[model samples]
Target: MILQLKEVNGMEEGERTALLAIAMNLVIFGIKYVSASATGSIALKAEAFHTLADFVASLTVFTGLKIAKRKTKSFPYGLYKIENLMSVIISLVILYTGYEIILDVINTDLTELRNSGFAIFSLLIATFLTFWFSNYERKIGHKINSPILLADSSHIRIDVLSNLIVLLVVVASLFGFHFDKIAALIVVIFIVKTGIQILMDGIRVLLDASVDYETLSKVEKIILDTPQIIKLKTLTGRNSGRYKFIEADIVLKTHNLDRAHFIAERVERITKEEIKNIDQVQIHYEPLQKEEIIYVLPLTEDKTSISPHFGEAPCFMLVTFKSGTETASKTEILTNPYANIQKGKGILAAELIVKNMVDFVLVKNGFESKGPHYVFSDANIELV
Candidate 1:
């Protein structure tokens, strides 16, 4: 039930963000177009067209989010790549807007500047709104882990800078200085830069590139932290739209098939808890091959013999021996850190052995009714 909630909430949040961006773009477009007509500034007109392009891109993002949610028997994995496709489309639109702005700068003459104060005031308002929306949308994008929303937010952020340049150009024209064409050219550069960045990101995801190193490292840590996991063979993750898909292979200390599966499920659950927007986790596990067995025995202060009490032992002896052999290949003595703990010492001792990856524990008697017994059982550590 909790997992279902996460999926539904993610989609709803992405859709809401896209819709908000569309509305903001519409408002900014009207403001910029009105101001451009009033002041006859070429830069202002270019900005108006850029805002229009943003509107189209926002609409594209909304459509993509809607379509990405649909699942069919023909496409069981969902149309998640549609979000990446929308990002690509948005990049193309941005590139076209930049090209149009460049052409306007070269071909159009700045008309007589009028209502200079009104133009500056209107641009100031538009820039403020764009700045606010960009930050807000970016925050939400990261929260929901939506690629399209993040792309749109980046597109809108560039608009804020372009609006400022246009405003400055309008102000300069009032003082009998002309920089409209130069300002429009600068805005074109920003638009093109942002467009290229978004294009690369979309292409990488579409090609099934590996997820960021930071995320993969976190997943590796999670898998390694599981007590029963002896080795993490491979871990791979990729982004599909706003969600992440993961695959991992691991070796568990237990030879029992059911125990291996249980450990895998535990890993999956913990991974989902720590990471956001995980779509699926596929884990493949195999039992450890018994070449050598590591046995831990709770020992007395002298470390020469086993202690009758498991948790109250002052130290422990670790013996490693090859399978079917009686002689020990290696032996080491370790001081029990939790021996002095007044309470829960048994459970802590069990955890200590699990953390050391000991295959078996030699006990004087069965700890069937103790806390340590359950801990050892859960970790799949055999008792001898």
Candidate 2:
């Protein structure tokens, strides 16, 4: 699903191949049916029935490709699932084809079935061709993760089996036991089994069944990694085609709506970037309760000066302002020197209140925010 028909270009190529397969099946079936009729061989007839099944299956695949490609006005989601439904139909066609082989084998003359050497040879060729085609399709299907192509590959696999059965029936008929009829019955049973299996799988998908555990686990991990996400409570996911849609509810230890909104947006962005084949993501946020913290401001200043006559290294001065109460009366604090003394490098600075409480407050007291009030620790002036 990840690399395959998930994109439009891949879908188009797959559809083209399906159409080509159907046309080829039609040509092969026509040629085999004529040869089988002329030979009057039970095994050839069996092979012919298998070919007929291929014809029907191919047509179903073609129809499915068309339906799958349609973007309906009524259904906003594309009709990609129709391809699986068509595969189910093809399976039924295979079962019917097997059944017809059994019926024809039973109703025909046993004596006429003996001269089917050419028919048996043709079935052998068909078997080899179908086997090769099935293997090729399987490789591509696996690469793209396309269910339709995989189904077609399965159809080819069954064709190979049916041809083998026909070959064996011919050989056994030549060996003198009238076992062609029995072989036909075996083919019928095998086809029925395959048909039932394909139908069940298709129905399950149509019902929106859950995917495997590995996929769910991966999705959960991605959601958990979303930024600012305290916890993920529930996650529900579904897929229409190659795109997986997700809905998740997340919680955080923040009460601010703006923060929650920002976190949700981050979560959405991160989830999309981390996960592959995701088309849409919806996140719901729940705020966790926490205390409303307030800030305290502190006053501070710093200065340096040079003196020539005294050859002093530098003149430095220290000043301090402390808030006596646990909570600063004002939200902001500013500092100024008591005297504008021979200003060489005198400056003023401000700090804001960071933490406020009845007992003690945390303030951005200059030079790295030490405590409750701005402490103007030092100053200096230079004389010419």
Candidate 3:
């Protein structure tokens, strides 16, 4: 289907973005590291470590995607949760780096920082690359709906802002204004905030928290709008990394067991069509309980004559009995779709009757019983 192809394309795009992010993060890290060592600016050093954290986050995204795509039959649900687990690991790494940066600010001698024009050039480069890359990766992340890429993008966004503050510190030192440690402390706060945010999101996915309320509402609306589904009993949905899965139970206002199944199938199809991100949908249906005896009769067009043939009949007349007495009746002259088929007519007709939820089939006296008779017998459809 076109939809399936689009999904694959989106996934490929996410992978490509992750690779790009790793390269950019590494470049930023190297540039910042050089400046930090040359001038001994605490902010520059913290920014270097933040870039390193971003690099690791990018690697985590790549590894998670590779593992998630290798799902096997033993794990039919796939390995999507691996992405969330990797996110958690990435967040903890960032948190540790953040604490280190905070401690460095608290313990290091701030008065020893050396002012240098070359450090400003390096910081400028770091700032521009991080700001541009963050926006680029964020656009890609949204395009593919990838949580890993989005998480990594968030990390890079903080990198851009922190790099700006580091640049300011370098500029201020050149103007006889020295508050490098204070600026570095500001960067640490931003880094820690981003880490906590990513950590909470990862933990939520690992715990199987329910999806957003808007998505849940949309799901409920889709099921309720299905024609034969009279009522929805229950609905539960959860996220798996960037994807979603839903399980539902519904009540159908139909006495026929076969029609109930077909309705449920329609609901599942419609739900998937309406919502593209849902990777799995499980639907359970119950038929309406009513005291009725239903019978199906093969008839000629206009209901004027009996058709000895079952599969070739132009239409069928449905009759219903209640309390062992006639309650309601209807005759439908629907086209027999299998009439022109050369083979499998009997099976198709049997399936049609089952879909109608017929209890009995009235046949003309001399009707043959090779194909349809056997089919009806297997389905417990009495022929008389």
Give all candidates' CA lDDT scores.
0.90, 0.59, 0.80
Listed in order, each prediction's TM-score against the native is 0.93, 0.67, 0.75
Query: Judged by lDDT relative to the true structure, which candidate is superior, 2 or 3?
Result: 3
Say which prediction, candidate 1 or candidate 2, comes out ahead on TM-score: 1
lDDT of 2 by residue, 320-344 (tens): 2334445433342223332243532
lDDT of 1 at 230: 77
For model 2, give the 10-residue run with minimal summed lDDT.
375-384
Candidate 3 structure lDDT:
0.80
Clashing pairs in 3: none
Q: Write the per-residue lDDT of candidate 1 for residues 15-75, one digit (tens) a residue.
A: 9888988898999999989988888888999999999999999999999999998989998
Give the Å error, residue 310, model 1: 1.1
User: Per-residue CA lDDT of candidate 3, range 211-247, in tens?
Assistant: 8998889889988655456578899999897789999
**Which regions of candidate 2 are displaced past 4 Å?**
1-6, 241-243, 253-277, 290-384
lDDT of 1 at 166: 85
